[model samples]
Target: MMKTPRSFDHIDTWVFDLDNTLYPHHVNLWQQVDARIGAFVSNWLKVSPADARKIQKDYYLRYGTTMRGMMTEHGVRADDYLAYVHEIDHSPLEPNPAMGAAITGLRGRKLILTNGSTDHAGKVLERLGLTSHFEAVFDIIAAELEPKPAPQTYQKFLKRHDVDPASAAMFEDLARNLVVPHQIGMTTVLVVPDGSQEVVREDWELEGRDASHVDCVTDDLTGFLQGLGAKS
Candidate 1:
């Protein structure tokens, strides 16, 4: 477990990553998206499902996102790709009362930072009954198609929201993506997925010394905030 930084008192705005961070990964929303991508790849490339999966993984690894790879290599349009991938029904997502309460508990302007389109983010928020918790949803479209891990994207987001980096917190499921915000002095929290046995890797630690900015790492959102003395 990592220790919480004493400088965390400066964090005031809380930016959350939608999708897997808002809900547990076990809900299988990404599994549905993965299947859709595989099918699209199989049909478009005329390959077997297994072969298509391998190709998709190859693209995802080569480009930060498979859509980026497709656009670069095959000239796939970004809008169409994002629409197809996010078309999965989100009715299966049940709201976590605990998460709802936790979001309400965190004192600050709450915003959603996502690579997904705003429409997709709205659907997910509605599904999780968390639409009211966020002051606004910042999507890939709003960021001019730049995604997370891109320093410019983070800069644009903070500027648009008038968020002070020294007074903000970003909670995300992806450890690598958290690096940019952590570097900019935002309190970073890594939400470990349930049932995952792998130890949480510290991006800053992996780079060298402990990240002077990262604040906490935990699987339980509510418990973590409660420990932080956040009040509803």
Candidate 2:
């Protein structure tokens, strides 16, 4: 049932981004963390909530991640920031055995490359019942705080896994993050938010669906993977 054997025949590594990429955006789990992020910035800078949001977005745009921006420009402690932002309730997430089955079908070494901490990745994967699907996790801490879209971060990940770019695929929710991977010869897939997403997203984040670097785009990751030889 493979949709296109030639497209994935050489792949031996499957890299996934945690958070919005692995799960549907409608889960609302990340909205809680996002709100916490704004609050943390407001408290840290003694700025109004509105101003804090601006600062947060600005940093995210400029540095690929708000945490990296905070560290580079404001000397924020990584551990404290990560812990504070991720303290919200985990009740929003629900396990998806179907998705796990699809992931289980991929014929390669699976991995998670995330800008967030590994602890957060563990919690999300556990909730999704996908903890065993991935073999290794390359988190922000492993990147030395450099976020993705940074060529060097991707380089380190590729080197660590001994991944041949031509034989690997990376799935990410953020379109911009795939730029470097595309340039380096990896097949890049963009996981878009489904229609069920009631959560608001920035206009800029939604603007890159037509970007040349993205090899595939899909709102239903399960179907996409299934088409690529996953089980129903």
Candidate 3:
């Protein structure tokens, strides 16, 4: 059995990952982004779809994010990569009233902590009608081009916000991205994607431990927040 941390007694700041964690992955927004990324890799590298997929997966495995791998291996600029990859149609992401209520329900200062660019984060939050939900959106650009899963980036965030690590709760969709925050003493909640049968991914297990640091793992964000005593 995984050891659960003590109930988050000290938390007063809630940091959320904007993409898959804020909205259900079934919304398929990321599916569109993935297709775009695959196409970009195929066209840019002059590779077939299979090869592009392989490269993308391999890079994501080696580096915490594909952009990091791209920069290290192909001299890709961070700004250009973010601009190209996040250019998705926002029409599909209609404002989710339930999500908005859940955000309003949660206590304390809310912030978006994502590996995405701030402009992309703004667009997403705007589309989801969540622009007012957060006090700030800390994007990858804020980290001096470093992405999540990097200890320095999280450290930098804490310093920038003047946040006490022990008083923050980080809710993230990707398990790999939660490792550093967990290590740094934040209450970590894994927003398990809806409809996923597997409790833990093999890659995340190999990259870190087997979800032991996670305080709670749930698919229903609204319900989970309610369970935590959030009031709408």
Q: Say which candidate scores most in TM-score.
A: 2
The estimated TM-scores of all candidates read: 0.85, 0.94, 0.89
Ranking by TM-score: 2, 3, 1
Which is the better candidate, 2 or 3, if ranked by TM-score? 2
Alpha-carbon runs more than 4 Å astray in model 2? 1-6, 230-232
| Model 3 regions more than 4 Å off | 196-210
Which RMSD values do the candidates have, in order?
Answer: 4.0, 3.3, 3.0
Name the candidate, 2 or 3, with the larger lDDT value. Answer: 2
The Cα error of candidate 2 at residue 40, in Å, is: 0.8
Best by lDDT: 2
TM-score of 2: 0.94
Query: Once model 2 is optimally superposed onto the true structure by TM-score, how far is the C-alpha of residue 109 displaced, in angstroms?
Result: 0.5
Worst 10 residues of 1 by lDDT: 200-209
Of the candidates numbered 1 and 2, which has the greater lDDT value?
A: 2
| lDDT (10s digit) by residue, model 3, range 1-232 | 6485746667788899887788776776877777777777787789999999889878877776778888898888887788899999978778877777776776678888888888888888899888998999888888887888888989988888888878899988877788788888898888866675333233452333246777778789878877675432
Write the number of the candidate with greater TM-score, choosing between 1 and 2: 2
